[model samples]
Target: MASFKKYRVDGGKFSLASIDPADSPFLEGDEQAQRDRLEQLAGELDDLQNLLHAEGRRKVLLVLQGMDTSGKDGTIRWVFSRTSPLGVRVTAFKAPNDDERARDYLWRCHANVPRSGEIMVWNRSHYEDVLVPWVEGWIDKAELRRRYAQIQDFERLLAETGTVVVKCMLHISKKVQRERLQARIDEPAKRWKFQRSDLDVRKKWAAYQHAYEQALAATSSRHAPWHVIPADSKRHRNLMIAQLLVKTLRGMELAVPPADPSLDGLVVV
Candidate 1:
């Protein structure tokens, strides 16, 4: 079993350096065992989601962050396909629109947060404000530091308000990302997903890696810690994420809503 340390809450950050990818016990399991576990976890997730919806006491926010072609969309599609769409919503955060730019950076994100009885997934979340902007020099160092502190406070507030936030950072090697991007370009149907900006970002791979390291270190807190999933293999990544999500949801201790008591003796002819 992999002994993972609980993320520190005082500094409001996660120490990614502490995690060893090779130590992930799930990766060593046989294919059949892995499949069985995945199925079991998926079923439990369905039950938990239904309970959450019916109880309507708390909300869940799943935030996925990764480099280009790191399989954020694929993870969402595969892991969440079986989930009830009515109780779940997905929001993909792209570059700021005019209205978004005019407001505070977190304004647009807050608007899309999950309400009680719903689960919301963020394809790229508020972390981008600190990650991308800081990496690409769009924001200065001082502002970047400020954003980290602000994000921590924001999440603390959300947690205090009955929101469960699960932040995941899909970690893929540079070579793997390159291969995935190439595959997209080679396959006609996937060509539309490829963008020139992707290559530009790829060129600064090291910068992004350092940026991620810093972001995770600064922002992983008890309220919203980052789960760094090894994403080189799509199947393994999906299974791990599913397991983690189900485990977290089950921890909430959700129960089905009770049947209405008003109907005592209604007889059908």
Candidate 2:
């Protein structure tokens, strides 16, 4: 398997345009085989998650950011299919409510951090504070830079507190997004997921892309690095994220806690 370093942004040096969303370097053989591999990865993720919950010491936070139709929900659905929900929490951030807007942008994010021995996934994260405001001309360049710094500091705090932060930007082509959006509009069963406001966002696609590039370049760091997953293929996206997560947890060297010597000879009544 190819190293995900090719997709990682480190030291603020990255070019989103250079990476093709259609590329699937990690895939082999036919589509069915790819599906099989993804299933295997999902099961591995389940086991790793179980171990994480058992160890009960550290936290894992997975942040997912992307364009409107970039498959954030789909990725979570497939990647965590086998993992128990008791140990995995999903937080989806939409347009901030009036109460949330009353406080600092990071307030809601801070409140959602994972607890020890659990995995928390943020569907849209604090990155939105940078992306939407910039694309809509709400925040000036200086404020944008300041927010980037604040984000880095916040992530550093998470790292210092024993949270393993893994961020991913789901990369998909505009044409693919259009097809998905259109499918949502055409299918009655999926129409509820479609929003008229999505069209407005599509009009500013280039602006949003530029905002994402800037945000990713500015915030990706060694402590909480960002990986851009090729998301034109849903299967490929799931496989890459699952593999990345499994690799991360494996690197943590998690194991069952040492058994109590005094209990070695004890038997249950």
The best candidate by TM-score is: 2
Tens-place lDDT digits, model 2, residues 51-118? 88889999999999999889999999999998999999999999999999999999999999999999
TM-score of each: 0.90, 0.97
**lDDT values for all models:** 0.82, 0.94
Q: Where does candidate 2 stray beyond 4 Å?
A: none
* lDDT value, residue 80 of candidate 2: 94
What is the Cα-based TM-score of model 2?
0.97
**Model 1 lDDT tens row, 29-105:** 78887777767767777788899998999999999998998889988887786788988899999999999999999
The alpha-carbon deviation from the true structure for residue 181 of candidate 2, after best TM-score superposition, in angstroms, is: 0.7
User: C-alpha displacement of 93 in model 1, angstroms?
Assistant: 0.4
